[model samples]
Target: MDAPRQDAWKDEEDLLLATTVLKHIREGKTQLEAFQEVAEQLHRTPAACGFRWNATVRKEYQKEIQDAKNSRKATRTIYSSSKSSDDTPMSLDAAISFLKEMKTKQFEDYGKENLETQLKKLNEDNEKLREELKQWEAAWNEMDKLVHWVREKRKSESGV
Candidate 1:
């Protein structure tokens, strides 16, 4: 449960995480996406960001979170009544408008450096996962071999 001293979350970083999460909430995005965004900016893992939020930062931002959720609900209500269904593709104009809206909310808030950080984090995570998968596979193969040996031993003992 203890974070390394060098990886401690600072006040500014906590504030950044909170605000980013709130904005994502207002935009109707998942908290995990917010954690991923903050992970890059904070140079930490998304899981770390999420843990910090749930364990400490979230308590301080309850009111803001509620407000963001309310705003998101209102926005959804406005869009939900539209004739266009999810199965149908949006028109080019609608797509443009949606992207523009997202740009105003996002590009103005986060700097260019954040994206490079996210990509770096993603690469690191990918390598870590690959290594972990290899370890698990090796252990599984060993277990399979042991089980096969045990079964053969039993069969030989039974003269089958």
Candidate 2:
């Protein structure tokens, strides 16, 4: 039998009720007891008090769940191996000679890893740009089609 408010429950009232409910629960009161007390104090039903309590607490736990998921991803290790195309058999001396020549011809490339990473980033950026371009082109094409249709209708109506 409380007066109806133009807006939803006020922030101060919600915080006060939530604090009271949490305190009662922390003091070893059952949820039912805490809910009843909060419901009476807030001039709301038991269900409404329970709903608000759940909304407030659920948000906090949801954040914690997301934090745990992010931490798990950060702690994981990724491994990858490159494939080689050599399938022919060669003598040990020839293999060693080829390896030595290959190593010498290729400068000690400290930047190889960096180059590959940059290439991957560039490829991803290119894909994003391509997608945006496609969307823009589609929108422009639709506009052009609409304009042509309108012009054609106008010409027919004018008997040209």
Best by TM-score: 1
lDDT of 1 at 127: 100
Q: Give the TM-score of candidate 2.
A: 0.32
Tell me the number of clashing residue pairs for each predicted model: 0, 0
- For candidate 1, report its TM-score: 0.49
Lowest summed lDDT across 10 adjacent residues in model 2 is found at 73-82
Candidate 2, residues 1-160: lDDT per residue as tens digits? 9978764678776766656655443333456777788778778888877787677644644554455445433322110112435454544534444556457646456368768989999999999999999999999999999999999999999999
Which pairs clash inside model 2? none
Give the candidate number with the greatest lDDT. Answer: 1
My TM-score estimates for the predictions, one after another, are 0.49, 0.32
Clashes of 1: 0
Q: Against the hidden true structure, what lDDT does model 2 obtain?
A: 0.63
Candidate 2 residue 50 Cα shift, in angstroms, is 0.4
